[model samples]
Target: MSTETSAKAPGGLRTGVQKFGTFLSGMIMPNIAAFIAWGLLTALFIPTGWLGVEGPVEALRWSGSEGLAAIVDPTIQYLLPLLIAFTGGNVVYGHRGGVVGAVATMGVIVGAAGTIMFIGAMIAGPGAAWVLKMVEKLWDGKIKAGFEMLVNNFSAGFVGFFTGLAAYYWLAPLVKGLTDVLGKAVGWLVDTGLIPLASVIVEPAKVLFLNNAINHGVFTPIGGEQSTEIGHSLLYLVEANPGPGAGLLLALTVFGVGAARATAPGAFLIQFLGGIHEIYFPYVLAKPVLLVALVLGGASGVATNLIFDSGLVAPASPGSIFAVLIQTAPGSHLGVILSVLISAAVTFVVSTLFLLASRKRDLAADAAGEDKLAAAVAQTERNKGKASSVLGGLAGAGAATATQTIQNVIFACDAGMGSSAMGAGVLRKKVQQAGIEGVTVTNKAIANLDGTADLVVTQAQLTERARMKEPNALHVSVGGFMNAPEYDEVVALLLAQQNGSAEEAAAEETATHDAPAIDFGAKPDPATSTATAEGEAPEGATPEVLTRDNVRIHAGSATRDEALREAAGILEAAGAVTGDYLEAMKAREETVSTYMGNGLAIPHGTDAAKDAVLGSALAVIRYDGGVEWGDGDVATFVVGIAGKGDAHLEILQSVAIQFGDDDTVARLKAAETPDELYALLKGGLA
Candidate 1:
């Protein structure tokens, strides 16, 4: 199925920038609350604050007294940077890495004590953690079985110690200098009245899902340092301004075509009020010409802020009116408001002109069922090179027009044989365990959507396209099949509808030890058509369809091509299909990913290559490191399928049930030998 992931990084410099920015943002985003806490204290207690009392408060802060103002310096100096380091390290290798990284970062902070060192923390935290990961690899399996914990702890301690010394002696000064260069460049732009030109870069990158990187990665640290010196920095306004996106959506609501026009009003409110600018991205991407409006509108906002010399005391996350106002620098409220307004007005007029010029063509295109925005949603996925959960949820925000009872739940993707199938199995298992009945859940390709199903579930990236395929059906967007919270939500909804309101079903669901709080909404029965409906399998115990002989534990396949070939070899050797199925498997993979979430991948043939099937069987393999499945995803388990009219569905369901949970995968990962792995697989599958 079309399972987009973060692996398909863009080519060359764009890829570097995007990945770097994403990595940086990841470390910073989690610590945003810390930054806000610091910002609030600074805004109220500092000399130029709203309070601006300028007497004992200033003296107390300078004296480092145990007062409200005392929190401001240490929060930015030690707390914020340390939090970022811990987060960055956690992403690399969990708690051990996090602790080491934070410890090493202390050296950098102390080395560059005069500088703010946000940039230094960004460098040392993940850098030291990465070095530690590589160092661990040198003796990974060589450690004596009994002394593993001792070696790991001592090795990490040594790495952190050296890394800390290195940071203090060398890295700190380099990062300090780098921050200075960036600061000077930004200053030059502001002085020369060229800061507005940054819109040329920021506006388009936002549409490409790179806004987080630009804001948190590059802007936040630099602006934060400036905010420490002055009360605010204009760099925060460069990327977080909501005016351009707001203007675009407003224009579309007034003069747009079909579904895009239909969804614009609600989308507008969500973008403006909630500061979710992603919902409007598809609109610009669907028609690239509209980017003109965004660039110019963003430029205007930057220009207005430049003229007023106004900026925010802290970064305005989500760029909503509320966030913007809350973080507005002292006496800059009018300037910030004027900038948002002026930018919106400029973009609305520019976008309106563009729409009018193309109104005739758009109407004609809509009449022909060419929904550009809907089509552009897929293009946007390609541009971003991965699926975003936030963007996915927006599809049904304004588009969920009707409430219908749930009976048929269709999990759709591009090819629909892989991820969708597993997702369907996941929901089916939940439905069965809940004792829900009568509902039929199945998997299908997006092209196969026929308006028969009451509910359609798809990856967030594909939700819009699925909506177009079946306009009347209710749509549910999820990040992926494995361990998606949406499954619980759906089950909860069904339980609620079958007995009471969503809130009422909470206690009923709570009695089931596995079920969490009630959040889903589906009405009544969920028989959840299992794969058994495809073709009846003979009554069996784990069947010949899957066996220890058909399983390969810890297989080493370096690349996607190798993984596909290896999977095909297992199926062929098992006599499940003729050798010709290998080519079909490759072809199928080329069309879309079979990489399901939670470290699972399923490789199977296409309909065109169905003739190669000799017997229905399944072959499972677990990669040691992970196979490089495209679109920025890694696959640990690769299941090759050769179905004779769905004879393998039962085994597929078993595979799904076993692989769908993180705890189960952890147990599988812990298996020390082939025999141990096979025994666990057999126990679970049976």
Candidate 2:
């Protein structure tokens, strides 16, 4: 789960565009080094290069294909695009997909001739891989054991052959035409002198975390092509300029209040020198009025670059002053430097004014202990609907001062009915009992998984689908509803995050630290636990829904059918349900497998057959070796339920939270008698 994203996102239109942008970036970000090498070669060895003094290197210029210069054109023309295709294919499937993607991209490169096939690869690479994936699914379970290799090899060969042929004739022309259209649009923007107006779109989007997409995904391809044609492209400087962020941080440092002010100086260095523009987004998010300063400042920088006709030969990553200078085309130093200075001055002055206007309120907020920076960071993640690696640069956002907060937890399943509802009920009650605050747990069908959830919980079988639907939220998989066992882990994680030092939240393990304290009652020190006879049920097990008779230590079961029948027999023998409930359980099992994830299965009558349940009660049977529950699922514990009008839900709510801990589950599995197992469950829940 992205529990993420205001940048490439979880929303509708914005999400679609962001995901597409992220897709393109995924294919390109890994290959930036190659582009840099090409840029350096062009900058140093060509006739107009820094090394134009003339020598063997000079003669081996772009015109002379005998040396370093010879490597330039071929590198960009062949290697870079192919690498992107293979990477995209790999993301879709694996090595086989990569091999097919590359072969298909070769067709694109050849068909397009003089034009670089960046866009072509972007389409054909993933497209071919997707087709292969779909084809494989057609024969997924039907492949004979021995003939699998032969069928698999032939299928891939056919896919690659057809995919390559399709790209050569059809996809190449369509993509080249699209590239030409975009080139024309940029030309029109420049010719009309309206190019600087792009800052209006760029600045606000940058604050929302779209900088990488705008710079690398959209701008880089166009700018790289332009640079190849004319030595440098001003488009490269549009999004890479760090002046707007620098100016905002400076103003915040001089006039802002509280955490925003305290963090500004450190953020400034990270932005202006370190080239990490994301360091200052919280400043703007904390005070949206400062966006005016950002836009005007960015526009001013673009205007200066336009006037000076100055631009970098390659993309300036991190947008740091150093990177910009390193990639600066010859004779453009004064222009580039002036643009950065002027943009910073513009934003600083504007932001300082805004801070002055709100100084009184801001001071009061600080006095009240309001953490605007931290709040904005949480808001950023909320807007994104998930987590972002770039966002990790923010110190207090989750890594420095406070861990990222999780406010919304979603429990998702196929229909948002039965299983998921029960799981949510269990976790929600446990959360309330533990006095967890600022957290709301809700269930929704996987199909309705909105981007707002900070965390998503699903059955293992449904997890992949959930991720595809909402890639920005955090996702957790649980095996069964009666034994949700993952609920405790989720709660502990939330606790760690809420306390501001989510110990495991550190994506980069730069230091060692003590583990956070977990509050789940399953683990108690021996000193605090009451002693009892080894096989005696605890006093707490006297609850009507659970007792010594409700639990079994070891049961022999070979198949899912046997497990369900034995479980129903236990419930019947306990007087919790009439014999008619067995048919209801069978019907429910036939409709939907009772098997959950891990090693737990909960069997119950259907809603329409609630009349069969004589009263509210529960039964637990453990399998020593575990029984096969079909579709690769194994059930070590079968929990049979009989309730009057949904009373089993309450029974499940009381015990589900205690099952998530590994030690807790292990203790139940190791219990030597029904009394011991019953005692463990009742004691833990109590």
Candidate 3:
């Protein structure tokens, strides 16, 4: 929430002009073809045609109005704005339509439509922002960080569209006047010889091959038909180009996907299917310098077309790449060749540069074989146990081994870059806080680290992944080392592992040091173990076993929010997590999804957690799901949290995973329902 603005733009007026120029250039060839087609149908195909069909010559005599309608009716109108908004939304939000969201957004856009979609754009940005925040909260803030930029930039366009529209509508006349004045001033200068030299110096840069290609080769043909009013020629320019344009688009995809991994799926849907160019504007804005490359590319293609005098055979829809190629005239083939080559070359170089620059930071250490061994070695060193040999020898002599056990650990998570680092940080801190040495604490990607670690502490998706990756990790899992969990198991385990008992440590630490003795046994009556024999199973499939295979619970737990906080640690450990946890937890509290009856609070994650698990465990806790929980409907929260890997039955690993079934949930929600809920739970796991 810092109010800072960065000075960079993908393209300004110049870029806009260039885009217009390119569009105009692309149009010319198609316009010519349409003109020819109309003229032919009007002339030779009319009077002498079959089936009493008369051409323009014959038809115009009977009804010139119809002919006019034919020409004007096909023109694209306000649909243009919708197209822009759709693409813009995609670029910003990475979602397809935003149907209801977009509709709500469009009201603002409509309010500003007369000006340019500016007021709408202004409102749309904030509107989308507000809704997205809600989504982030629901998802536990896991997807928020990655999607923020997309949202901001995408929304900016709605603002800009309105702004631009306003500017164009109100300022065009003023701009035209200025242009006239400038033109006169330049003319005067040329006459006086003072400006002639300036023109000479500037003309070369302006006259690069692209201008010639566009103006002479491409623009001339379309401009000719447009001037002649040849059957919707104006609409032809934006049609999808077949050859070079397709290549350019493909290149854009590769570059874009490479830059944004998960975000790319959303972006791709907008760009390719929706045909929205504005979604890509932020990329250019991020690196304004790259606009020059696009310009050069555009200019070069235009110049090449002009040099070869290539022409389009007909107007093609901007949505169809094949149409553009098919419509090129036989004689203008050379221009087509040059256009494709120039655009592709420029795009390849610019995109390649951007891709390389973005990827330099994200490459895996194990990408090359050399780094893998080193990383593995480092990992082994950190995780390997270390203890006093004398103690070990004495224990071994007594038929025991003094093995090192990690009793306390921490897991951290932030949005994206910060989450993983934070988890690792907390782990280190917790290890130090316990005053324990040689404990194995490490950080791993939430997604990949699922079941590997003993105790998982994570922020978002890592928790989800922890649920799936190392369901086994949960028994050993400790709530976040950074945050408090529902239970203080770490403190319990630490005290247990210490040289003295809890009371002894409290006395010794209180006298010698200022630190209070950490208490882990807050829950005097441990949660009723939900694990039952495999005989009782859920309806769709067997209950997910809360064994070492599928759960990662944090050690310590906070007060009421303990389960909530622990959920994040599990998500981080599993890496199937995101969004804002606080918001998500609050919403879940309002309508506790975990309808754990029979004196249990099965606290679970919101729908945003990507993993699917049968209810992880039927929480048979001593306390109910808190009176304040979910409108007091949930006295006991029987949580059914899971990860994405459990899409099917065979893959499921916990009993709680089945709670996700709508029928089961419905029955659980409505059943008289604790006993009914218990029956349902038992039946599902039966």
Off by over 4 Å in 3: 1-75, 79-299, 302-320, 323-337, 345-686
Candidate 3 at residue 559, lDDT? Answer: 35
Q: Tell me which of candidates 1 and 2 scores higher on TM-score.
A: 1
TM-score of 3: 0.28
Mind giving the per-residue lDDT tens digits that candidate 3 earns over 132-180? Answer: 4334344342446568566644544454444444434453344334434
Best by lDDT: 1
Count of steric clashes across candidates, in order: 11, 23, 119
Tell how far residue 143 is off in model 3, in angstroms: 33
Better of 1 and 2 by lDDT: 1
Global CA lDDT computed for model 2: 0.69
Local accuracy by lDDT, each model: 0.74, 0.69, 0.35
Error of 1 at 381 (Å): 2.3
Model 3, CA-based lDDT:
0.35
Would you estimate the TM-scores of all the predictions?
Answer: 0.74, 0.60, 0.28
Best by TM-score: 1
* Cα RMSD for candidates in order: 7.1, 13.2, 21.7
